[model samples]
Target: MERLTDFVLRHKLAVVLAWVAVALAGTFAAAAVQDRLGARFGAPGQPAYEANQEIMRTYGGGLVPLVAVATEPVDFARLAPLGRVVTDPAFASDDGGTTYALLYPPQDGDLTEEITQILGPHVRVTGLEALEPEGGGGISLVAEILIGGVGALVVLAFVFGSPLAVVPLVIAAAAVLAAFLAVYGLTYLTDVSGVVQYIVALMGLGIAIDYSLLLVTRWREEGHDVRRAMATAGRAVALSAATVAIGLVATMVLPVPFLRAVGLGGVVIPLVSMAAVLTLLPILLATVGPRIDRGRPKPSRWAGWARRVIRFRWPALLVSTGLLVALSSAALGLNLGEPTSDSLARSGPAYETLAGMREAGLPTGALSPIPVLAPESALPVLRAVPGVETAVVAAPGLIEVIPDYEGTATVENVLASAPPGARVGGAVAQSIGFTASVYGAFPPMLVLVSLATYLMLAFAFRSLVLPLKAVLLNLLSLAAVIGALVLVWQEGHGSEPVWGIQALGAIDEFVPAMIFAFLYGLSMDYEVFILARMREEYDRTGSTDQAIVRGLGSTGRLVTSAALVLFLAFASLAAAPILQVKLFATALGLGILLDATLVRALLLPALVSVMGRWNWWLPSRLSRRATRRAPAPQAGPTSPAG
Candidate 1:
């Protein structure tokens, strides 16, 4: 590490130029990514896929008409130019004005505008096509980053009280852009979800800044000695990145292509950030760290807070534990359902057109009507279903069923009740299959993540008890975050006023697994940062109390500051146009903030103080060698940042 830092300092200018080239290439790659990206949530081998393949085989491969409405008619001849294919005359409304039209979304051109121009004001258009572009725009995503960057700068300046604080933000941006470049290349190899773009951009921003914060803070603490700081904090950050990546990489094993792509995208953020932080960070610190270190701000109050916590450790532990437990209890009420089609893209033709139709006294589910293809022999049984509104014959053997306003019949039930050769499909069936694909594969994926993370942390901390404690605490943090997610998104507490996120009633089914993997791994990262230092101090002096005090007092502010940077980055996601982005942004941001403060700063130090030597205890089979892997920091001069 010392040799690496020396090389960086020696050729700092060359290092900067290389990164400049990297940043330029990364920018171009990010720009081209969106063209290759898509929003397919369908998992291969699902029932929905089979149904679609059959449909394509029966009719030439294309989207069928998705919506139909009854009202005064327009000139079908005039709509012809806009790609509105006039339907059979017998299928018209009771007053002879209703006609169906085809609107294929996710296409190359602007289908939303064309649909509006062709249908005009009187005719109603709804269904999946109503939602034009899913998720957020480049402009809104940029706004999120800019706003988060500002918030992170404020926290960094206050925490370090130096212009060098901006160094983390700079490194973070480069890491994020670099990850975007990697993901862009990834899109060509595999069909990457558009969600991966937001995750890499937003979450990567926070994570990269976090690793940078630790390294920079350590440099300041080492009296601006870049080499020694790199040798110490550098190792910690690398291990930290690897440990977090373990959980992320586990997602690749999931059968669902959507989540597997997300997992693959997630691992890139930490790796890129780790590379940039270790290489470019040292270059910046070696060249500019001393200059910015001059005129540090007045003494931070964190030390005083640390002392108070140590003195009143018992009370702090009881209070924080009680609060965390209470919050986590809300997990029991979580409703595990996926986001509705309405929530996919809230500000588009798909959403607004439905709102207009609903206001005009149309059936609530009219936009998302269902089609049940059954043999003519079972037409009576299909129409007998309570939710069925209209049953029409499309061909000699095919029948289409439009559901009513309060359709409660699901695809599973509809399939079971259908005639032997019948099939039910459309938006409703697709949603059900998507949800099943996500949830059905969840358990095995979770087991893989949990078991792997546990082993990694056990190897890292070198204590069975300590690793177990870390896992349990991380689970608690995840549960609390899930509760918070439900409260904010499902219950609508602080959702509408802050970001216009409505009461969703139920969350995206994939949210819980995501929350668990991300929060557990990140919280463990902070755990390693704190406990590694504590273990180092204890090894040197064999005094648990002294080690706990010095360790927390030293790393507490930096860890919390790093957490704050990530929280701000995630908070920006709440403003995203996509419902999934909003949920992810809000949940992750809140979770990080909560874990860093209440869990890490207050609860952790207090618990270590109470546990004393037991915190470092390991079974005989693990060996004393496992108990101590890294050496204690050499006794030397300390700077103001500590």
Candidate 2:
């Protein structure tokens, strides 16, 4: 370990340059082949999502789903224009407007059935509510300025004492913004959804800024000379960035085009931002020289408290245990149900239009149900099921049924209110066999996938207790964010008075889960990385108390800096025009803040101290792997005092 650290320190410049070069090459290749990189999400034979184009051309229209309006007492004039829209040369229809035919071939049989059921009842509809026009309007302008500009300003101020912190964040933000524009450009060349492009850009920016912040913060703390510090910090952060890339890269396993794009962007942009940090940030630190540290305020009272907590054993234990109790309760309140389409609209103008239409007498009941597409011959059998609401045969193999709504609203609701088991799209897809219903079962399937992820972490850490603790901590953060989202976007409790947007219903179905998946992985990355360092220190020294303090204090600047970079990266997502992306960005960025401050800084240290001997405890069966013992609890600082 000493040799590794010494080698990293000795050739910091070479190491940093090597990282920068590789990252640059990757970014360039990714951008150049952005079309191909994106193409990886499409059909089995073809590259990209070009299949969506053929679906669009054959079915006639674009890739986005259209929402149809159905009412017995409909406003003829208001809906008159929609009749033409339904039959327009640009549009396609099936089931006598019972189904809003895809502009492309149906992605999945279940999705097609679900769409048919949802539209079956509607008499009027439009292109799956098109996003506000390009270039954005006044509301978008305000959102951008406030959410991106002001939000970034406030966070930078809180995290870094000097204005210099903003520099790397700005660079990261620019790199991310450029990446988005590049994605937008790729859409012209390849068949990419606008929303997917929007998400990719935001994700790229947020992560880049975040990782850069970690590097710069460490550089400032360690280097006697700014250049050397920059080099050292850059090397460490670059490695950290690589780990993050690995975690995000794992997301490619998902079949959805948008998720794949997000995962790729998450990997690509961080590497890009890392290059900028290694090259630009270090140069800037050197050129700005000593001025970079100028006008820094006295450390806050909390900072002092932080130092003391890190040093003491019982206090640390108390803090961690306390957090565990409080956050655990919060996690208990989590509402993990999928967000309805109405909820998704809360972010933009389309929401109000939908509400007006609903008031004008649309079926504004529960969320759209799952649509079951089975052999038309099975219609009676489905209707015989106790919960099935309405079932009808539309095509040769199609039988649509709306189930009696339940609180959980599982995929059984297909064709009426949203499908049951839709929460697990993959499992549903697998269960149904073929490539059918992948999207329908996504909502339910993800819960299992997330659980599987937790298990993997446990297996890796080799501790039933520690993995549970990590998951519980992450859940706490997730719940807090969800509560905040519900209040801000749903009930509209204080949105207008606070953030200046009217509250919408639920967020998108995919938004919350994707955010959870992305952040859960990212948060775990930090936990693993930091714990690895702490464990290494404990292995060397027999003092648990000394190890806790030194481990935290030594990595203090690293964690703090990394948090800032990550925060910036996430905030960049909030800058996008899409409300769904903004929600995801806000939730994820906020999650990082909570994790870094409350979870890592206060909670983790406290719990470690409290656990004492038990922190590294393992079963006798695993005793062979536990060759070394952790330090026993002690009362004082162990660092050699200057």
Candidate 3:
């Protein structure tokens, strides 16, 4: 590690140039990333996917479902110029004001232009991708990155007590740009989501800043000796990145490509971020740290608080445990579904026309109707299901069922009613299969993550019990996040007041699973940071209580600052117009704050205080090989006066 730091210091100019070159290369690749990205999330081999494929091949209109509204009477003649337009005259409004149609070859802008030329100025045309505030783009989220980056820099300044905090922020931005390039390159190897580009950019910024903060904090603490700081803190950063990356990379084992693509982004973000910190951060610290890091601030209040926690360890542990338990109870009410189209807001004319229709006494599912391919005989069975507003056979084997409500029950009943020759599909069914594939992969993901994280920590700490305890605490952290998600998004209790998003009565199905992967990796990262330091102190002193105090004193400010930066970074996602992004940002921001302050700083120390020497125990043979048995432990420090 010392040699590594020396190499970076000796070749500092080369390192900077290398990063700049990578960033520039990445910028070019980033431009083409969106075209390589796919928005589809449906699971292959599932009924929804199969049904959707069949519908697409036969109908040719399933790809570009839209609505066309006219202030005057409908004009079939005017719409003829648009290519491959399909709709029924009967579905138009009774007043001949509005009609539903599908514009084949779903190019939103071209279709909108063509429709506008034909339907006149009064026509309002909208489609699936048009309803969001921003439609498809990749790696160009400079605005979101800037917002999160500025907030992170402010927090860094406060943490370090210097304006030089911008150093780490610059490195983080470079790492994020580089990560975007890597994801773009990944597009050639396999399928990737355009959304992954934004995710990589934003998440890369946060993780990179976090890693740089650790190195800078350690460098300042070790009297600005960049070499020694790198030897210790840099090693920890690498291991932490591995654990973090492992949790995300585990998604590759899942059966779905969307998740795997997302997981790859997760892996790339941490590793790239870690590389920037290790390479760029050390180079800066060696050359510029002594000049910028003027002096050490006064010891933080965390030392005093750690004293109080150890003094009243039982009360602290019990109270924190109870609070976490209570918060976790909200998980019982958790239900999962993707965002409904209405919740994306009527940002375009198609949704505007549809919303107006429903308000004007159309069926509840007027905006979203199922396209089914069934024999004509199955019409009665489909109609008998709940919420069926109208069932029309457009062709010999085709039926479009418009339901009165948009609920899981509606899709389930319709699919269930499919006879021998029927196949049901639509946006709702696609979402169902996407949700199912995510959950289907979840159990394996849980076991995979638990075992992988456990093994990594076990090797890092050389203690069986500690790794298990860390995993359990990580789960507790996630439980609180999930429960809060349920309360805010599902129950709609505090959504509007906190964020501008309305409670659509369902959480995005993919959000929870992705959240679990990210939170697990991050919580484990923090856990390793704190516990690794404690283990170092315990090995040196042979007293658990003293080790807890010193370790918390060492890492308290750094961990909290990193968490705050991450929370704020994730919070920046709320600026997105998507409700799912808002939900994810809110839950993650709250979760990080809770974990850093409550779980790591306070609760962990108290629990370790109670456990005493056993917190550092390893199997006898392993202990003999790894660590020397300390002589009989001395008494710990007495409680200090406030």
Candidate 4:
């Protein structure tokens, strides 16, 4: 750490110029990144994905087809100009007042506007792609970053109470651009998801600022001694970044391509951010850190709060634990699937058209018709399936089944009755396939991440119980975040009023897994920050209660400030028009805030105080095996201060 700091100080001008060049290159790369990104959600090797590929190969289109509805029957053949138009007697509503046809356009063609032009004004055209909220008024990526930047500036000012606030922002900007460059390179290697762009920008901003903030704050606390700060706080920043990377690693190892891309793209956020903090940031601090940090330091009130918690540990523990338990209970009701059509677009031509269909008593399931590839002789058997509303032999060896609704249950019923060689493929079936393929592997992934994180934290903190407690608390915090998501977005407890989105009926399929992977590590960041300091204090004072008070007092405000920065970055993503993006941002924002407050601030301190001396118990046998040498023992007072 000292050598790195020395090198940065020695070549301060070169470091600044190099970062400036990287940032400039990254700006251009960010503009081109969008074109390279994909939105594909197919899980390779899954039956539905394979089947969809086969159907698309045999027929013109296989994935969810665009539905065109009209009040009067016209020459349906006119729509053939767009693509293969599938029509059937069952496509018409029972009332005969409404009719619909499915258009399977070219795989890569976006024909919604062209279809609307050809079909004329009277025809209402809608599809999976068309159902997305226009988000015309929502803030763009630049605007979101600017807004988040402004919010972070405010928090930074409050934390440092000076021009030092701008330093972290600068580090954050360079880190974001660096991460963008990494993601751009990733695009050439793999099909990166469009979602990675938003994550890399916003999350990169938060993480970079967080690392810089920790380093700068510690530098100030260390009386502006660059080497001392780098040795102490710099180590914590590295550990914090590692924890964040550990969480993202879980996602990268998943079999899903897009998810793997997302995880791969996300991992660079912390790595680049850490690089900037450890390399570029030291130069900035050594040169101008003292000048910008001219504001008089103000004592944090969190120390008093910590002292009070120590004074009344039992009450603090009960209150915080009870709140987390209540919030976590809401997670039990979390449903994973694609959002319903009603939740897709609240106000648009597509929405009104779907509304008119509903008003005409037309089955909305026609919007997401299931395509099954089998012998034409299997049509009658599929149609007789309990949940299938209608089935038709659309081609020589292809049959399309319209279910009563779009859900896994309907897909399962069709699959059960399907002939031996049949392959069922559609949006719902794809979702089910994704759930089975991705989440089926989630348990082992979770175990792997947990065990790996436990080992890492155990080694870093040199304590058996502390690492265990941190892991368990992080899980509880994550559950609470999901529960809050369930209430806000899934159940519409506050979603409609706050974001103007209706109850989504279920969370997006990939959301929970993404949230778990990201949040587990992110929330653990605070665990490392606070616990590392507490361990230091315990070693110094040999009193558990004093360690708790001193540790929380020193790091509480910093953790809160850092978490607020991350939350703002995440909150900026809520302005996105995509429902999945909004849900992802909300979950992460809520998780950071909840973990920083309930889990880190109140529950963590209380629990540590309650555990007393056990918090630092690293058995000599375990310590020797982990570190190749047992750690020196330190005696501490057993009880919490009254």
Instruction: Tell me the spans in candidate 3 whose CA falls farther than 4 Å from its real position.
Output: 6-17, 31-35, 62-140, 338-362, 625-642
Alpha carbon deviation, residue 489, candidate 4 (Å)? 1.0
For model 2, how big is the CA root-mean-square deviation? 9.5
Q: If ranked by TM-score, best first, what sequence of candidates would result?
A: 4, 3, 1, 2
The CA lDDT of each predicted structure is 0.70, 0.49, 0.75, 0.85
lDDT of 4: 0.85
Candidate 1: the clashing residue pairs are 130-349, 130-350, 131-350
Q: What is the lDDT of residue 105 in candidate 2?
A: 18
Could you tally the backbone clashes for each prediction?
Answer: 3, 58, 1, 0
lDDT for 625 in candidate 1 is 62
Which candidate achieves the best TM-score against the true structure?
Answer: 4
| lDDT (Cα, tens digit) per residue for candidate 4, span 379-418 | 8899899878889878888888988776677788887878
What value does the lDDT take at residue 362 in candidate 3? Answer: 52
lDDT of 1 at 293: 72
**Model 4 misses residue 140 by how many Å?**
1.9
Off by over 4 Å in 2: 1-206, 226-235, 255-257, 283-303, 307-507, 524-543, 550-572, 575-577, 611-642
- Model 3's number of clashes is 1
lDDT of 2 by residue, 197-306 (tens): 44454455455656665555555566526545544455445555554554555445555555555565555555666655665555555556357665443343543544
TM-score of each: 0.83, 0.59, 0.86, 0.93
